[model samples]
Target chain A: MTVKINTAEQAASLIDKYDTFLFDCDGVIWVGNELLPSVKETIELLQSKNKKLIFVSNNSTKSRIEYIEKLLKLNINNIKLEQIINSAYSTAIYINEVLKLNKDKKIWVLGQNGITSELQNFGYETLTLDDIKDKELTMENINNLIDLNVGCVVVGLDFQLTYLKLCITLQYLLNKDIPFIATNIDSTFPFKNTKLPGAGSVVEIASFSSNRKPDAICGKPNPGMMDSILSHHKLNKDKTIMVGDRLNTDMKFGSVNDIDTLLVLTGIELESTVSNGHPDVTYYADKLGDLYALGSK
Target chain B: MTVKINTAEQAASLIDKYDTFLFDCDGVIWVGNELLPSVKETIELLQSKNKKLIFVSNNSTKSRIEYIEKLLKLNINNIKLEQIINSAYSTAIYINEVLKLNKDKKIWVLGQNGITSELQNFGYETLTLDDIKDKELTMENINNLIDLNVGCVVVGLDFQLTYLKLCITLQYLLNKDIPFIATNIDSTFPFKNTKLPGAGSVVEIASFSSNRKPDAICGKPNPGMMDSILSHHKLNKDKTIMVGDRLNTDMKFGSVNDIDTLLVLTGIELESTVSNGHPDVTYYADKLGDLYALGSK
Candidate 1:
């Protein structure tokens, strides 16, 4: 059962227990353009106590810089860009540091600008959907396709995903044993009061056609995303807690990494759902603002 | 072990064994624009013997009429529209017959003209990718969404698939327990001397986002395609044989329905691969034209 940290004393005790708080952005802090109440104050409280704050998100569509801009708009300011880690950034880190992908080899990215920029930032050669589309490559010329320079294929949420893009991605995946990476397979994105297909949809299309599984998924619930953060900062895992609205991605990410989790009901999950699926969660709150109870004590 | 029907006597004996012959088009009879040698004469010979001919294909990009035109071009003439069954038509039949979807209920089709025409033919109010694209539905207008007339979501090979179309299709599939039908989940389609992502790729995108398996796949190896034909023509199952180049879909379709299957080498399968996966195939021929040995006998 999830321990309800409702009283100000209990919340304060829980807050005192952790040295760092890793937050899931969309659900825990804000829902779209509107910021949730008390989020700014709670973060300020944690910062005043010298607790490290990390914003980890699965949204691969935006770069860390863009995410920071959005955060400033929500008034959750004073965070360094280094503390913001999205899936796009995490994927690049995994490729560069873990996979040791050659700087000369290119990644055939089935995603938008964020992934392209991140791969380029890591000094890895990158090819975007536009690169594949601009060439007008089809089956007739596909056989004569000599430039198999791609070392990896990364699939993420692409609004411009096309059949031709998938075909090229499939060819690289099927013809070679190159690494296949997906940022995250989060099925849906809560978009503007409705859900839309996310990166998982694009990954599924390529995986189904190529008949291969992704070698690594650099996102929540996968230790890879947290591994990048944990390795970058020598933080004590025992004193850190992951706060998120979703049990599967956020809470599972925490549990998988041997960190305690706090389930917030302000996102995709409910209280009952957390209890049913993720009994490992250490605490429950209606929203991240409810954690304001912690500072009162 | 696959019994090789090499000699005229062996081929002739096999031909005489079946009263009806269900043919898989792409690999069995033709490879591309070029007709496989002896296929025309062998098919004619089968016709002369008064054997019922049925063409069953998982390719849904083409309508029955268009397929007939292609068949005539290949010189395998005399196949009527009704004798032809493709995944698109089978999906429409499944929706109209098995699902008994109300006439008032519309289907949002993520496919080309083939599926759109078939659904319209069945008198189901239909919306195509073009319809979704024309409206330019986005996340802003998604929540107050008024149009919810869709009762089913049918996915197939769509060259013009867009993100907006996938979003709309996902909405219909997720918001309600609507029938999710896919024409075929064939990973890739042979196109212009190379393979392109097929209907399965499109379906995978929707299925992954919605986190739901298709309620029915109206294509090969599922027996739904064969069921459409069997119920329509009242064909004798015992005396029927399915001939195809691919083992998984065609041979599996035959074996699953208790019909004998003849493996051909002109398309995807080789004599070796067929033996490995489907030893249930009763006979093997190098090509459909190789069945001219039957006529010689």
Candidate 2:
């Protein structure tokens, strides 16, 4: 059962229950370059109370560092590297810390710099589209271009996706020994009242072509990724409340992980959709700004 | 029960049963540029006996004229346009005769020249990758590149596929009003002791990205394509027999359409696996050229 947050006392009581707050970046705090109304005040209020604020985004198109830069530009500064957990960063962490892949086992990335840059940060070599984007991929030369040294393949949102990248990625995926990891399968991301193809859709090409299932999908509402993030950061699960705009990815992520959830109306879902899909939402607010009722800093 | 054709008497008996032969060109008639042994004699014999032979291939990479040219190079001559039924041609015939689309409703193709050429042959204008291959595709310019005039989207094997083609194809597909057609979903086509991504694999990218299932998949083991070919050519069902190697595609195609099938052992399938997948196969042969035992011309 979800309670409506209309009164300042109700918002304060609910906000007081959690020591840490996990936020879905896109629709919760900001949309694109502009932050939602009262989001600044709400963050400031939480910061004054010394509540741990972490931004978790399913978007693998941008790295956490890039996200930080974007967030800073929006004047939401003082975000530490670990405080932001984008899907690309989650995937990189999963591969490096969890998978503990040997240094010799190179990863072939079929995504944007978000994935490649994050993987590089983990001290792993990756074959990006840039390495062979200009090289001709004929039947006679495809074998030469395919690096057998690649022991893993990472897929994410790649706006610059090409047939050559897919072909190379499929070749790597064909080897069942080489683990396949996808950032997310969100299909379409919300864009200007429309939906654009997401990381999951991009990964489907290689999956369909190779007839291989991904070994790991590092995104919500997957509990594995959430577990990895929580464990990696030593986050107190009981005290951390998931606050987001969407019920499926955000609320469901909290529900699946047994964490409390607050549904904010500033993103994909409206109050009407609240009655459907995920009924496990703990609370619903008209906007993230509603939490500004418990003002401070 | 599948009768094995080994004896000359059995071959002659089988040959006399059918007035028309539906051959899968890749394995039944020829493998690449090389025609199977005794194929020339068998075809000559069938021609002399007034057997109406129709070449059906799931390969949408080439048009009927192109197939005819390739056939001629292999010493197979006297082929008419209507005698060939490639998946691309089947798609064209289905769109023209069955769908009977409006002239103003143009089609955007995400494939090789085979599909575009065939669609053009049927007097339908198409927007191929060539039209926008040079243009820059950004968020700002994508709307201009998408021709909402496209009433249908056709997908097939495209070795020269690009991100622009997929984005444009996805945009056209997102509008549910436009019909989506794929050549086939065979995943991979058999190459020299290996498998390469097929037309089906190529189509999967756009299908995945758009999250829209195709209106029609014009290939084997789909009986729709076969029905179109038969209805167009005015072939007698009772006299026609599908002869091919692969059980899943060629044999299953015949089985689904309630047609007699002859499994040839020159392609993807072996004689052992025939008893597994499609048990409806009427007969099995060591090779297609085994029909040479029924010699005449």
Candidate with top DockQ is 1
TM-score of each: 0.86, 0.91
lDDT string for model 1 (A8-91, tens) is 887788889999999998888898789887888889888999999999989988779888898898888898988898999989
Our tally of clashes for model 2 stands at 0
Interface DockQ of each model:
0.66, 0.56
Would you list the C-alpha lDDT of every candidate in the order shown?
A: 0.83, 0.82
| TM-score, prediction 2 | 0.91
- Give the DockQ-based CAPRI class for model 1: medium
Error of 1 at B253 (Å): 0.5
Residue B137 alpha-carbon offset, candidate 2, angstroms? 4.1
Best by TM-score: 2
DockQ of 2: 0.56
Retained true contacts (fraction), each candidate:
0.81, 0.53
